[model samples]
Target: HGGLVAAGEMTRTYLWRILFRDQVPPETALLLDNNAEFTGTVRNSRTLWQQDFEQPAPGLCGTPALQGGCSLALDAAHPHSTEWVIPARPGQFKWVRASAKARADQMEWDMNRMTQYVIRFRRGNEIVKARTVRLQRALVDAGWPRELHFDVRPPKADFDNVSVTFLYYGTTANLLLDNARLEAFDD
Candidate 1:
């Protein structure tokens, strides 16, 4: 005669006891059961990180910012930089959009021009740099802030880190950076 060996609950209880070496606590098991309901579902795009540079001393070298005090100032002498480490998750995020607001009074010339901004995605030995967006000279005349944007499709699977850098590249322009954000979108 053949019959079912065990139910799902029975198997789960056996494994839990074996793993924890004790009976599952009621509160802990309830919390796990509740969380299991939301697994394998898609949520809204998450804000991986954001920085307004509101710190009293911002940037890697603690550079002083301008008045209003919510931005980082970078020049050929000091290039404000920051980084984020992504976790090792399988198929969690497919694309990333990075954005920031900036303005410059002057820039260093590298035959072409100074880079307004750069985004770097790095994991293991693979590294991808989003194309540099050139700063326009008119912003100085208009005295208005310019928005910088970059969309990066990670080159290889399992990208575990990203670096957002504002480079002066030998330019004399004093670049003002504010409202930097990294957003992840699911496909």
Candidate 2:
């Protein structure tokens, strides 16, 4: 229902015709699926993989999402593991920062190594480079959500893909991730 409404109509077209259209956000040319907001109706043009956990899954969507809807959730009982791939055009940027709003439900347990995002650079089916950023015990265990990011240099001159894999193999910690972003910038 992002651009469509009931009766198989487009809300934007209808609103425009009625002269009641709201302000529309400008189209971005950098990346797609920077936020995990789209349903199956819309395609992610840039990314090869992303998460849309709209349907209820175990420990998923337990709390309100930071942006559009549903965050990636992991519980000790579930031990969720998933990966997200974003298009990497390293020639146009100096660095890419991958970030998300991440938090742990309780602070009494060790958070380090409990959850981590493994960033990988791939060319075709081969992995060229990788870096794993574990959730910091002090930052995420502060009893609140925080914006965590890993500033990564793009893989090599010929690399074409970057992926982040979320892994949790703990028995006592619960984690939540929302509003993921992959930004390639010159600065």
Candidate 3:
């Protein structure tokens, strides 16, 4: 008779038992068979944390307006209407848009608020080569809630820091800003 030689192999078994009295069944035994109790936890662990891209209070010259108010208007002549500078890493982005509102006026104003403007980005002394973004909608359309969405792509290489700025050319009008956010999607 010939016998085979095993080099490196191991076998193990796990056994669990629960003891309950005759009056009641063990609670732990019942939990082992129930699958509904552990439904959504075992899938994914990634979460999203949103940060608002808003300027500080002192940045604007006039009184800081709230979202509840009618419109948000800053002295265009003033240097600092609202300035927001955020640090960004090199990555592909689906869209970059800012949301704002225009005040209701019966008179025929320039409707400058309705017209769109450009958004620029800079890095240090040199300006990053990119196209301008425009404001597309008025706030009163959807009950003073306006949002602008645009597609943008920053250079992947040779860029260290990013400086964002909003430029608009219009007459005096009330501009409302409820909320503004910059969203990026993973490739």
Candidate 4:
């Protein structure tokens, strides 16, 4: 099978599911937000996750959104967002690559809050794991958006949600996020 797409269906396909092929190596999108671009309408869209961050103190945008003149903005006081992607069936999977483009309005080596781009996994309200790309002052100072990716190995297969959010530990600073993606890889 080729050019096959499945969403929120509890579906699985490989070179073969009845007889697994390690060499063929199955790669499928358990959650699909390829560019993390928020370009959908209610008429036809993926309704599982927060498609756009226009609520909870409604903001400008989400995903690779500078193109749309918007991005998911996060500050220290408002540290995290929720439900970027929800897998159709999380228990059948082991590894996921979470990615996003991040840019900070301000970052300093010792700022009360230094922005960290994160792929957060959750079983419910509890955070199962956080994979982070710690931003350096110099990188932010360079004035170019950084795209980051990391593999998440959940301690268990029960993680119910995946979020690409910007988190700040301290008390000040802002981070802009775009291009959120959560993709599954078979192991």
Candidate 5:
């Protein structure tokens, strides 16, 4: 199965719990905040912004991290593009992407405004295949919701490091990412 295991097949939910929580584990003290570096700019009556991941909140998943830590980044030079990266264990892992209630409105706008966000992976020297999750209209009606669960198996050749990116249209508004979890599932 490489690292692609079915989360439902797990015997205990402890691993799943730890992977999804926002709080840093005492044993792993290397939490990074990437949201602090975002440079907000307004363009053509629109703006793009980014946020960092500090600690995972309860019932949340997939905090947005940038090039350094999990956070958001926007390049004014490319007015229509914004990027979000999340770092995880270098293997086949399943992630649950979620957001907070406070950011529900903006999240809904971003989903419905422009094209859908695209998710991709980067290894040492090569970029892997890309996956996309379209925003559902129902989610917007409820409020700007968060996340589309992604189950991906990264390239085995580059187990030392891996990065996941979300490409958004320049018109996308603010979004808050939280509660990111990675799980080892049964094949």
Candidate 6:
């Protein structure tokens, strides 16, 4: 009899808690989203243009970005085109290195003329430096992802902007770019 009564009391207490207990409202969870600016540091490096190509931001063009998100598929139609323009404070960065995993479907392609890409730095209206990697044609023809790294030391004075460009020279090629990074260094 005592065991039965204890069980009944426990069940009643559980039911009462379920019916009368207070919960934290859903509105409280939505408070942080209203703030416009982020207060913390998002990236560790002093990178100038580190584009994972996740979002369509202020400085990109000729990019019909990949369908599900991740990379930029540069439009073959836009030859000798500057894809991204990133602004920088004068003299903030000394050395710059641009790198990416690039691939192409065409076997016989000429990077020297047809598909030349350049990482150019500018100061106001003057071009400070332009760097391009001279990749071997056989390496690209293997149908494997090639790692391209182009480094440049811009003029120590000052620069207004830098451009990530593709000098297609009016030729079409099936190219894919991923994990593109334009990192800046003090040295």
Best by TM-score: 2
**Local accuracy of candidate 3 as per-residue lDDT tens digits, 61-163:** 2223434322234445532334445555564342333223333232212334333333334565355745443232222233233444343345555544444
TM-scores, in order shown? 0.57, 0.60, 0.47, 0.52, 0.36, 0.55
Q: List the residue pairs that clash in candidate 2.
A: none
Give the lDDT ranking, best first.
2, 6, 1, 4, 3, 5
lDDT of 2 by residue, 1-187 (tens): 2331224322343334335434332221001112211212322223234454555465667466655667777766656555666666557565656666776666434434457666778886578877665563324244477776555566655777787777776624456777666665554
* Candidate 2 ranges with C-alpha deviation above 4 Å: 1-59, 64-69, 76-78, 108-112, 138-141
Instruction: Provide the lowest-lDDT 10-residue window in model 4.
Output: 24-33
Q: How much lDDT does candidate 1 score?
A: 0.50
RMSD of each: 20.7, 15.1, 22.9, 12.9, 15.9, 21.8
Between prediction 5 and prediction 6, the one with superior TM-score is 6
- The list of candidate 3 runs beyond 4 A from truth reads 1-72, 92-118, 136-143
Question: Candidate 6: where are CA atoms >4 Å away?
Answer: 1-45, 54-70, 80-82, 109-111, 134-138, 170-173
* Candidate 4 lDDT tens digits, 71-98: 7766544566654556544654455665
Top lDDT: which candidate number? 2
lDDT of 6 by residue, 1-187 (tens): 1111223223332333335435422221111111111223333447777666566333433244332354445444444433688887656665666666665556434434445556667876577865554332323344466765555566565678888865554334556566677887654
Model 6 / residue 182 / CA error / Å = 0.7
Is candidate 3 or 6 superior in TM-score? 6
Winner by lDDT between candidate 2 and candidate 1: 2
State how far residue 118 of model 3 sits from its true place (Å): 5.0
The alpha-carbon deviation from the true structure for residue 80 of candidate 5, after best TM-score superposition, in angstroms, is 10
**Given candidate 5, what's the lDDT at residue 185?**
36
